[model samples]
Target: MERAEQLFVETVSASLENKSVSWKEPLTLNEWQRIFYLAESHHVLPMVYETVFRCDAVKKTMQKESRNLLQFYKRMTMNLVMLQTIKTQEYLELVQFLQKKGIWMLTVKGIICRELYPKPDYRISGDEDILVDKTQFEKCHKALLEFGMKPVKKGINIGTEYEVSYMKSGSPLYIEVHKSLFSPESEVYGDFNRFFMRSAENPARILVEGTEIFTLDYTEHLFYLICHAYKHFLHSGFGMRQVCDIIMYSNMYGEKINWQLLLGWSREIHGEFFAAALFKIGKKYLIFDEKKACFPEEWRKIKVDESLLLRDILDAGVYGYEGRERRHSSNLTLNEVSRQWNGERKNPVLQTIFPSLKSMKNEFAFLKKIPFLLPAAWLIRILRYEKEMRKNAHKNVTDALKIGNQRIELMRKYKIIE
Candidate 1:
């Protein structure tokens, strides 16, 4: 790894472990900039900033570096903490409102994982993810609208999509109400939904700021974290924040988790090696202690190149939003996975130009009601893409294809594809 990236990993790992960074050399301005950008992109800026300030070396380096950058970090971190506080209160209120309306919601990912952190507000989340019973989806939808939250996509409801997003006007509080844990339309991860079919029926309640909220059971929640990371990995990539979530969750509930059962579920999804690699990465760089971790002996047998996976995760950033080309390249890799699973080879370019009706239904919800409008929708989508990427369309596509091929090779190395 490059020096900046190495320092970033060390700093973040130290922060998560509640330890001081052990860097001896003073970081140059450029090095600090790169490290800060990496922390920002990976959505761990607050944690990194907090940990770095506690280090004597970083403090000396900061005295020599530009103070403006330091101030920027301070401002951003404070804003994030404030936003997180507001969102948490809003989430508690919404949960209470939903409970009164006879809606059973299981909070997942964002809020649940946030509490596991040292400073809950340090872990910034874009939105709240809640899983509700399919039968109670309409009631949940109504409750959200009644709570002054508007649907992000108009006309989104049960049977139309796996999840519906809502945003409150004049506020940063966004909530994603999921009818199923994973989208059934997803060719690769659709099966993941089956694992959580009974999750809402028997959930574990936890208190957040004196308000009780429901969440998945310990084992299932940890498995969901792995599956969530795997989903992002197949798409583009997932960053260190996700890895930290796994580490923290494991640390808190290591003794309570059913490691064998988790392994079985992971193997069912062909994610055993990937899951093992994540834990391995955690132990190696993030101060995750395997001796105390409740992983099975089988995980040690799983051979995966941790460095390659770590590099990919760092490059991809949070949910692969770091680069446009990388996001576009994900189409090729995803298609390759589908082909391997379903024994069908789809030309990624053709698939992009002419998406299936089900795929088009997502962006053009009207297609669900009027199937005949697909051609018009396709044309509109193509026009939109053209307008957005008119200047570098060809170059971007070429680079995406090149990167896609490289990622496919990486997938093979990781045993995700053959």
Candidate 2:
């Protein structure tokens, strides 16, 4: 079994066994191996463990029977080791550089993921998800440049940190510097007041080897997780790390989170049910203070399988599908549409029909209620759109149509479409 995979199991077992783990040290090899076995027996190897570990270790440990699990992690950005080193080192540098620049940023996911394992080496990550005060983001970005860092994308590509992403390569690590915490696509994301009003001011935290790692208060973290999970799930599915994120974070900081705080954040984010479902799932795998919990009817209604679906889909997006192009267009591809669907920009008059966030959010709400209905609706829409697509699919479609009889002859001759 791979070390990180083993660590995931141990982390979960630590939760199950009610043990605490330290993520900055190495454990005995036996401890690592047994934990992987535990995670495997629980059937969470690929979906759960794959999120935090690097791929080479998977190859190093689980060679035969662990093939599928190994492959899955490889595809999901096999740069956990590189990410960790970069994050800790970059953060240390960023802290110093920003102090000189008089800018302060908080570390988010980078340290949180590592904190879940017995040592940073046992788990893996790809980026340092950091959050900075929106007002100071530009200054922070500027400060980063002085330290030889740059943002990963521009103009709404989105990063985990305030501005997000600066790379140095042949080296591992992508730093996601976020301006805000939630996904930009979320319904309330643009409303600064809403986030601030519901945000936790100075939540309880854990110290990892003297570095202060901050997280949402128990209730607050629950709120953020629910909103985030639902936000991602609505987009595709929640990434697998999200599930573990809720599991691990909630477990690690269970005492500080509370139900009322969760309710406030969820309502603010308009993800009340999402937060509830995540809380319900968290409770199953870990223990929380019952006195502080406010399990609702909705929470009990959410199935674990749904959570897993959200996790898998979300992880795929973060990690991306490498061989999708080679896999011939399947029924799902032709029928079900996503943001990645094929289409070209046309003149503005026609371009107004381009799908917008409102339409996507509406679709997301509909799917949550009748989750299986999306495929049929998508198929119907595909058949309707296919006609439009043929014209847009090729610049020649319209030109070819002008040839009249010759076009039909060629259509038949080429078998372009029945």
User: lDDT (CA) for every model shown?
Assistant: 0.84, 0.47
lDDT of 1: 0.84
Per-model clash counts, in order, read: 0, 27
Stretches off by above 4 angstroms in model 2 are 1-86, 153-162, 183-193, 197-205, 213-218, 267-270, 285-353, 356-418
Report the C-alpha displacement of residue 172, candidate 2, in angstroms.
Answer: 2.5
lDDT of 2 by residue, 41-134 (tens): 3333333453324434433554444555445545532344445566666565555566567766556655665666545533455566666767
Best by lDDT: 1
lDDT, model 2 = 0.47
In model 2, the Cα lDDT at residue 380 comes to 56
Write one digit per residue (lDDT tens) for candidate 1, span 158-248.
Answer: 5677798899998889988888888776777887988998887778878888888899999999999999999989888899999999998
